[model samples]
Target: MRIITGIYKGRHFDIPRTFKARPTTDFAKENIFNVLNGYIDLEDAIALDLFSGTGSISLELVSRGCQSVISVEADRDHHAFIKQCLKKLGTDRCIALRGDVFRFIKSCHQQFDFIFADPPYALPELPTLPKLILERGLLKPNGIFVFEHGKNNSFEDVPGFIEHRAYGSVNFSIFSNREPEGEDE
Candidate 1:
């Protein structure tokens, strides 16, 4: 995987053949960051990356200047690889956690300015992730949450849905904590 821009721009990490995680493609990752750039500032923002495969997004977050990032991955080897990557980058901004993403969400009491999730597309619980995270109060007011899934899933009808973007087979559904403008309480 390669970081497309920011401090770590052009840096690449080789994923082991034994790994099962699918790191976001450079094309998709770049485009998503471009979309996010228009919505929020990563500078000093606190971020969360759930199902953080290869810690690709987490590393990119730090490279772009997020003050802190928490990366949660259920796979032990993936978690270890993420830590190794962070260490190689000499950055302490990202904390790699080896645990269940759902459990972490349920137990997390801290809010974040940005949150990203890239769970396995075939996972049965993929559809419920957005609602679960939003309902848990994980995002600070106006904060954005980007969930990546396959093209077969759609989140436009979901509450808090802001927009959806598709890059090849990868799909991203963005949500925000604040209600849309012009709506009465």
Candidate 2:
């Protein structure tokens, strides 16, 4: 896998052959970042990466200058690899956690500026994550959540869902907590 942009742009790493998590494709990651770059000021953003396979997105967030990135991966091996990658990057901006993403979500007390979830497409709970995050108020006002899934799912009708983008076989549904214009009451 490769770090597509930011300070670590073009950096490459290999996933252990025994691993099962699928990292996001570099092409898709690049395009997604291009979109994110237009909106978020990454330098101070506090971010969370769920199902952080290979720590790909987490690393990108750090390299792009997010103030802090918390990466949660349930697999022990995957979590270890993430820590190794973070060490190799020589940065103290990311915290790699080995735990269930759902448990972390339910128990997390801190709000974030950005959140990204890339759960296994086959996960039965995939469809419910948006509501779970919203109901839990995990994102600060105007915060964004990007959900990556296979084409089998659609979240356009879900509250907070603002846009959808498809990059080849990978699909992303973006949600935001921004209040609609002119409705302060």
The residue-by-residue lDDT of candidate 2 on 1-185, one tens digit each, is 98887899888889999999989998899898888776567788999999998899999999988999999999999999999999999999999999998899889999999999999999999999998988899998889899999998999989998888899999999998987789657
lDDT of 1 by residue, 79-172 (tens): 9999999999999999999999999999999999999999999999999999999999999998999999999999888888999999998899
The clash count for each model shown is 0, 0
Evaluate model 2: give its lDDT: 0.91
Best by lDDT: 1
List pairs with backbone clashes in candidate 2: none
Estimated TM-score per prediction?
0.96, 0.96
Q: List the pairs of residues colliding in candidate 1.
A: none
Give the Å error, residue 77, model 1.
Answer: 0.6
